[model samples]
Target chain A: MSPSPPQLSPKELSAYFAFTEVSSLLRHSVEKQLKDAGQLSYVQFQLLARLGDAPGGSQRMTDLADGVVYSRSGLTYQVQLLEQRGLVTRAPSPEDERSTIATITDDGRGVLATVFPGHIATVKDLLFDSLTADDIEGLERVLTQVSAHLRANPPRSAGSRKKS
Target chain B: MSPSPPQLSPKELSAYFAFTEVSSLLRHSVEKQLKDAGQLSYVQFQLLARLGDAPGGSQRMTDLADGVVYSRSGLTYQVQLLEQRGLVTRAPSPEDERSTIATITDDGRGVLATVFPGHIATVKDLLFDSLTADDIEGLERVLTQVSAHLRANPPRSAGSRKKS
Candidate 1:
């Protein structure tokens, strides 16, 4: 037989389900808005937003993948699509020729500007509206701890196989 | 020019970013565990879990999709794969001939049993370990509220276009 199940209490189980389900719904809701408002898939929008927030509007390809918790190959394809749309540009990194760097284009910023209002509104409507400020604080505090723990042993895209 | 950005306070913005980033990382970590342990993708695991938890270990395909916040077509393909693997079977609903019902097979439960230990451990490691009882309650309370709000409107698969 399989190994015995982990000893999680009912409350722990409920919180886990709640976290995953709510996050999925929140993502789906914003994905529709992003698609309708600017034709951006969630990953594409994340790519653009990350680049837009970066210094000089740029980051290494692998870093982009890690930042978004996406697969390296998937990030490459999304960046290529963004490049084709003139929303971002890809080039060999100055610090490392073997590594590619992606930078947001004027059009990318323009698209983000176009979508930011609706994106924020949707998040607020679906999430913040249901949350008190204390809830938000508790959320940020707990998730920040969880996030730090997860990030400490970073994904392969970020920490290991960087040269791949 | 684009409309102005929403007036989200810095704290609100930080909380939002923290929420999205941490959720993504948590998902990535658990997906790896699911893949390695049972060769199940996150969606596949969720589908089986939902079916396993349902009465008679079955649910309509559309309801399954919405319960997991997956696209209808995507859920169909996943179900087909599961069917091929002999982990699940699909049949016409007795009450509604037009709707397909997916039932978890014994093998599906076996696979879930195999993956259950690792899945629970991964969630606990990445999430529950860092959270206190109060944190768990707060997380559940806030997320349950958000989940209800999102579910009230429901997704296309669950509410609107049900006849489609």
Candidate 2:
């Protein structure tokens, strides 16, 4: 194999390492809070929270999968788990007979209602508590730019999904 | 419930969402690169890279787990996989008979050498490409603070592991 290319600058390396460690730790903290509050995983809470925020408390499965950055098969499995627990329901879409739609149930909303406070608190403690208002604005601007670029040029693995 | 504890301010909410999306996308991008370049998962790459970076090219298992934000059992599994591939070896620590030390083999460094360029490129493309130097500084500062806090008060699930 060809020799490794030039190394990243110290600044770049430091920034990337810190960004990664923070992300992992934050996810761990949030996952624990969700589990303790409602026995929910992070992605499960994301799906429920997204549906709770939707226009009709529901979204097409494909849409939910894309919004949450999950594989369609993975989303289907989580939805099935939620459905079994009575927190969500899946049905044939009215607009497209071949498509399935996922809707949050009253139980789902109730779970969100129960878990959200702890979620918010966990986020604040692990993330926002250390950041100043200016830091928040700066992070928002930087991450928003990066996120749009990533969404436009998604990884090949995620590009096969039907776009919503 | 306490009415969802009032919504986060738009600025805070936007920042948090952007942060979450950016973190997820970056991981996906990096995972794809590692898989293609070295047939490595992100966590496996992390362990290898960490071992390569450590002084004397070795570290205790518990220290590795804590540094990587992984569960002790999970780290044991990954270390075993690497050992099976002859990339890393685990031996009784001379300093502490009860502890096992993981050391990178020459083959492990070879794999990291092969994949580091692609890893750096992927990180730059998905993250640093859009970020200004000022953004890098801000991110490093904010994330370092957050990581330090989270490491100090790690999630309950991960707290059971012996700290190194």
- In model 1 chain B, where is the ten-residue run with the lowest total lDDT? B155-164
- What TM-score does each of the candidates earn? 0.87, 0.92
Q: Write the per-residue lDDT of candidate 2 for residues B24-126, one digit (tens) a residue.
A: 9888888888998998989999999999999989999989987887778999999999999999999999878999999999999999988989888888878
Taking the tens digit of each residue's C-alpha lDDT, what string does model 2 give over A11-58? Answer: 788888888988988888788889989999999999999999998899
Candidate 2's C-alpha runs over 4 A off are: A1-7, A157-164, B1-7, B156-158, B161-164
> What is the C-alpha lDDT profile of model 1 across B1-164, one tens digit per residue?
33556567666777788788878877877888889889999999999999999999999998997677666888999999999999999999889899999999999999998899888877877778767888888887877877788777664433355363
True contacts kept of each: 0.61, 0.62
User: What would the per-residue lDDT of candidate 1 be over residues A41-150, giving only the tens digit for each residue?
Assistant: 99999999999999999999988876787668888889889999999998898888999989999999999988889889878777777778888887778777777777
Where is the poorest 10-residue window by lDDT in model 1 chain A? A153-162
For model 2, what is the alpha-carbon lDDT of residue A93? 92
lDDT of 2 at B146: 76
Candidate 1: where is the Cα deviation over 4 Å?
A1-4, A155-164, B1-5, B155-164
iRMSD in angstroms, per model:
2.6, 1.9
Docking class of 1: medium
For model 2 chain A, the run of ten residues with the poorest summed lDDT: A1-10
